[model samples]
Target: MNSDGANDMNLAALLRAGADDELQPDQKAHLDAHLRDHPRDTDRIEFERQLKEACGRVMGPISAPPALRERLIASLDRIAQDNSPRQEASSTAPAPESVRLAQGVESLSEQTRRQSFWNRMTPAVRALAAAILLLVGGLFLLQVVNVGSGNLSLAQAHMSEIATFVGDEHDRCVIDPSRAAKFNISELDAAPALLEEIVGKSISPANLAFGGLAFRDGGRCHVPGKGDSVHLRFDVVDQPGETVSLFIQRVADESDELFESGKSYELQSDNQGRAVFGWAADGLNYFLVAKDEALCESYSIERGLTPNAG
Candidate 1:
């Protein structure tokens, strides 16, 4: 490749890395210098940003069915309450096949004539068929419970990480000039048509200056191991010392169970005196973190995190 082609390729690679937040400190500094000299390179930045946003919405949230969730919760409660080994259900039960046919299922004679073949068949075949069906049913139920438990465990694990990130970004916003409200919401919302078509809502910058809060500064950070996210800082109305900030990122698969897609949750505490909570919409995760719990709740509600927001 020619010199310009090589530079373009290098910049393109940097943009993708920056988009995914996979940039190392030195590489990030390198990208900043390149963008500083090559203003047109800002286009790459925008493209990468939108691409991350679009990807966040790539697959809709997957969650356990309500029935499965309930079963898992019950199982978890049981485990929590009693650490001692309990008798397995099977160990306490009588001959299952006999019990099933004698009580749970109709006897061969009681069954319709079409099923009388069950009686004509060898007892071993009948027992094997019943056992297979029971085994399959048991496996299926265990799978459903496992799926539910696994998802919830994952979502819970992300909570601490979220609290940590929100706190760090809040501190960063306190000093970053870019966190100030400079860009209009329309300009912020100017994303590709494909994104709008897929997501339905404008992926534009929202004017979050409300509820005694004014937009201050904002920036984007690509989280290592996680994904890209948007960060915004806000002044606490007139309370200079107090502050509010938020980040919106692509949700992780494990975190998808945090809510039904589009539902909001109220998060609390990083032990750093910050209150946090969030919701997902159109494939993106939205979180608001602030020192003031009331302020966080206010922003959440204004952003449509209704009365029942989790």
Candidate 2:
């Protein structure tokens, strides 16, 4: 081919590649070669990029609807039969007047046969078929609604849990000093091992980013032996005159049971002054929020954790 023809072919190939991001390696190499030949083709380059972006936007997971698939296959089969040689021959055949009359009678008879077949169907059978169709349709509609509603509900529950957990952390920090002084619990000099036990040794120190931890002069101690539970208390210096306490409990058995399930709950502190937003799933239970009973109640209700609230 001449240089002009070759360039045209190259440009066509590039355009095809640009239209779809799923182009093969060789196709990509060919497009690259075209770009090299036509280095100044800015319009073509932008076109290719836009095409790729458009394709990428739609290149995610997809599942076919079962009923739609079944109906499509049935329609295709009917079309194939209608286009078969026997059907075509019948359509093209020229009939005499008498033959045409006979054909009309046969068509009417065939219609009557179909009507009789339908009429012979038992009421139960007809009802059952209608019920099945309605059920399938209802299920499909339910799935679509759940795709939107279920996700939103789950997300809202998660946010509420996190918010409650943060509030609880703050309140715990505020009241820890009073609790320590009242109980004659040494505000200083607790076991470092206790902190490690509750927070999990696997949790990196880098992950501890609590803002409330700076108050109580940055002190930390562990409370031991509450059935595989660890407790931590620290001061938030930046907040000046506030302390926060964190507790980590390892409920392996409960975690295993809830690993594939979702749960929500309201937690109230012994003092009845702190509330917790709790969500459990996949073996982990998280509680978050301030030290208020009302907040906990609201969190629980919003998360569908409270019975008769959802």
Candidate 3:
């Protein structure tokens, strides 16, 4: 090919690699130099980012079904057997013994010997093997799916599902304080800084503390498929028994219709009678939950989370 044509192909390849985040540091430097000469290529970088985000939204995350999980386990077992040293040696040996054994273990002694391998395994060894298999399965499953924040879109989510998580977290931390240690509870004074560090934004107490409730404790909690989030527990100054929880999660897209600015959505009450309300602001999703719906609504209004509050 001509020299100009070759340079064109190289530039195209570099642009694609850079866009996909596969470029080495040296190659990225080259791309930077090229962008200086041809600023138009910068548009390609933006286009690729948008394309990747769009694809993630469309594909979502994939989880293995029970059937698929079983199949994966079986496949892994077969692979392990195929790669085993015993199988390798047997493959090179005379075919007659292997074929005969496959057809039938000719004697009771042969069957007993085959069973001896398992019989010799200690409980600890067997447990270790089982753990290895489970770890392998989990790693394989992760590779087959995208597990990003974009996987859960608040606009399409059922309020019941989100509210259920909020309610459960509240019960665990506020109602049943004995179990709060599981969440790695933080001191009241350090909770705001912890929330800011985790959520990547400064969330002052003024934003979450309201309605005569004072911060009692805060901690991290997992929201199942969504991810880990910070939950701040608040107790009424006068009525110590009355408590509320505010959950803060960093969202992939704060522009979701469900998160329209200054508006709160009331969620379905969980079986435990917790009232849940949620809103999104500044790239963070907030959930306010309490035993009394009136208390939750009052807090939402106080925080300017309700549409009419403004």
Put down candidate 1 lDDT per residue, 47-159, tens digits, no spaces. Answer: 88887788778865677778557645754443333222222333555445423322211111111122232344466645644554354442221000111211334344354
lDDT of each: 0.49, 0.39, 0.56
Ranking by TM-score: 3, 1, 2
**Model 1 weakest 10-residue run by lDDT:** 141-150
* Distance from true location, Cα of 103 in model 1, Å: 43
TM-score against native, each model: 0.40, 0.26, 0.44
Displacement of residue 67 (Cα, Å) in model 3 is 27
Tens-digit per-residue lDDT, 225-265, candidate 2: 12243334455444454344444344355222211223333
Which candidate leads the pack in lDDT? 3
lDDT by residue (93-126, candidate 3, tens digit) is 5446444332221221122223222244466644
Model 1 whole-model lDDT (C-alpha atoms): 0.49
Error of 2 at 182 (Å): 13
lDDT of 2: 0.39
Q: After superposition, how far is residue 38 of candidate 3 from its true place, in Å?
A: 68
Q: After TM-score superposition, what is the CA distance of residue 168 in candidate 3 from its true location, in Å?
A: 1.5
Between candidates 2 and 3, which one is better according to TM-score? 3
